[model samples]
Target: MIRFGVIGTNWITEQFIQAALESEEFALSAVYSRTEERAKDFAAKYDIPNLYTDLESMAASDQVDAVYIASPNSFHAKQTIVFLNHGKHVLCEKPIASNAAETKAMIAASQMNNVLLMEALKSTLMPNFRAVVDNLHKIGTVRRYFASYCQYSSRYDAFKQGNILNAFNPAYSNGSLMDLGIYCLYPLVTLFGKPNSVQAAGVLLSSGVDGEGSMVMSYKDMDAVIQHSKISNSYLPAEIQGENGTIVIDKINQPGSVRIHYKDGSVEDITVPQVKPSMHYEVKEFIELMKSGRVESTVNSHANSLAAMEVIDETRRQIGLVFAADLK
Candidate 1:
């Protein structure tokens, strides 16, 4: 029952349309807003009968087949290649662009319109992030993977009373490592992958973006450290270290309870049962990969969104944090 269609009314698109109406596998239909009175007041506060201010007439509509796109990040690879060249199927919202050549041109327009393109990045389709990737073999010999997600930004007090908006705008590529350190680097590149070296530093916000940061990636014998901030607030609890224990991830953007902690001290809570506005498990894995026709996502893969956009373009090239779609 796909249907969908949405582009940004914020509050994370009203919590992804209230987790796509508690998922029967989605059906909302339409919503877009360049302002047809804020898209008919966000389609009459989410009854969503269809309202757009023309994004190519809701991507040349045939009444929507897919589109979640939470816009801004230089308009996610040209609005996901104009809704995958109008055939639809796109669930963007993440650092799926603004680098790595607009994520390889939105994964080559979802492989030249075969459709289905994910990356909603709800922490690796979190069932407590697949119970921390199935208890990571009981944390033995993993090495290290600390993550962090800072909060502090009720629009950073109107950007410290200067008012930059668009989340501290850098021409809408926004910051804090593309809005909260790509949720601690997409679950540390979905449980460790791309990192041989990264090293970073930040605290820019003179409208150059990145109001906070810290990175360090190097990996063969693992090293991860990836704190992030919108200007500070972390309750701590995002570890992975190993040699027989420590998984603990209370929330790297809704990991929602996970624990392991052993080395003989003994503790385990390999959380799995999660379903709520926890973005209904990435919209039920993007409608079960578009009803098994599939086009990407081996747990949000397009080679893990181009290796998390090449580790966010080498941590915004060693933390200078440039954007304007990284100079086109």
Candidate 2:
């Protein structure tokens, strides 16, 4: 079994640990938080053997073979590089880093250390997601792709009341585009390669973070439009239009169902049933890749991470959204 240390105690981190517990090849060996009490509480809740407030101590410990980082966006690169240099594989949360430069640095660190590193882009590894890729051929030549993921944030009410939380704070590198829109952009890059150019626009909150945004990616034969917002919700599904048919995705993030609509006026369901908690698939892939001494994921490859980041970086450039990390 590959013993793992966790680097954050957020809800997403909890979901990952739950998935790890169900997997045969993974064990929760340690937990880390900036506060001792928080770390201890997390460890107690999961029966983890060790609790650490110092990241270096946890990285140097004999108890862990890898670590899953779910820390804030600004911390991903620095924390990941530290663990990698100490000879531990890392599975970092998605939107891999604040920008492409940091992503390249993290990739370089993984290569230099000869350890596995993967973005925790769980959607791409989902069986249903692969089914979408596999069935793309039925749609013929793609002409257009449109994806949107917008959910009304629970913290938005607080923001309206003059209290800005980290989710909407620019200092944390958090916003609608970085947090929600990435779900749309990653899948577009996964299905179709990088676009020739990108144009974007967004509404900025008083806190200097994006509240809602849209982008149109230009390709040779088609254009992909991505819409995202955290102040509202969208019930409409995402779609890919082609010469012969269209592929309908139920949701951009979780993607429980996918279907095809043909020119002949027929519809077919092509959904692939997936295991629960969804994060299980990503964990399994990470463990298998590490066992084989691979440094990057084939599904959520380093190139994939780079391409997605490039789009995000360009989009931010067009919309004038700058994070503190970009200044460094």
Candidate 3:
């Protein structure tokens, strides 16, 4: 079994741990937090044996063969590099790092150490996503792709009342684009490589982070329009238009229902049922790679992460969104 150590105690981390254990290919051997008390509290729920307050000590420990990082955006690069240098495989949460430069550095560290480093982008690994890929040809000669994911943040009310949180704060490299928009961009890059150029615009909050944004990526014969927001909610389904039909995705991030509507007024459902939680698929893939002694995921390859980051970098530039990590 692959012994796994987790670096964060948030809800997403909890979901990952649950998914990992449910896969039965991994064991939760260690838990790490900045404070011993927090680590202990989180570990208690899982009955974990190892509790670490220092990342270096956790990296040096023999209890874990791999580490799952779900820390804040700004901390992803440094924390991942530390684990990589120590020869531990890392499955980092999405948006990999603050920018493409940091992603390159993280990829270099993984290569230098010959350890697995994968972005935990659950969407691409989902069975339904694979179904969408398999049925893409039904819609011939793609012309336009439109995707939108917008959910009003629960913290937005507090922010409106004059309270600043990490989700809207620039110091931690948190924003709607990084947190939600990437969900749209990753699938775009995965389905159709990087675009030739991009045009973006967004509404920045008083704290200098995007609250909602839209971007149009121009390709040779098609254009993709992506809309993401944390200040409002959108019920529109994402669609890929072609000469023959359009593929409609229920949720761009966690696609549960996917269908095609043809010009002849016929509809086809192409979704594959998922028995396990959405996060379980990524964990299974990561363990399979580790067991096979592979250092990279063909699905969530380093190149894919870098390509997506380049788009994010360009979008941020167009939107005038700058993070403190970018200055560093």
For residues 1-328, what per-residue lDDT tens digits would candidate 2 score against the true structure?
Answer: 9999999899999999888778888988999999999998999999999999999999999999999999989899999999999999999998789999999999999999999999998888888899888999998999999999999999999999999998998887889998999999998998888889999999999999999999999999999999999999899899999999999999989889999999999998999877577899899899999999999988899989999999999999999899999999
**Global lDDT of model 1:** 0.85
Off by over 4 Å in 3: none
> For all the candidates, what are their Cα RMSDs to the real structure?
16.6, 0.9, 0.8
Q: Better model by lDDT, 1 or 2?
A: 2
TM-score of each: 0.34, 0.98, 0.99
Between candidates 1 and 3, the one scoring higher on TM-score is 3
* Candidates, ranked, lDDT: 3, 2, 1
Q: Given candidate 2, what's the lDDT at residue 170?
A: 84
lDDT score for candidate 3 against the true structure: 0.94
Model 2 residue 76 lDDT score: 94
Question: Candidate 1: misplaced stretches above 4 Å?
Answer: 5-22, 28-58, 68-81, 84-90, 93-118, 121-123, 130-143, 146-185, 189-222, 225-239, 242-244, 248-259, 274-280, 284-307, 312-328
lDDT of 1 by residue, 44-114 (tens): 88788888888988999899999998888788889888989888889998877888888888888898889
- Counted clashes in each candidate structure: 0, 0, 0
Clashing pairs in 1: none
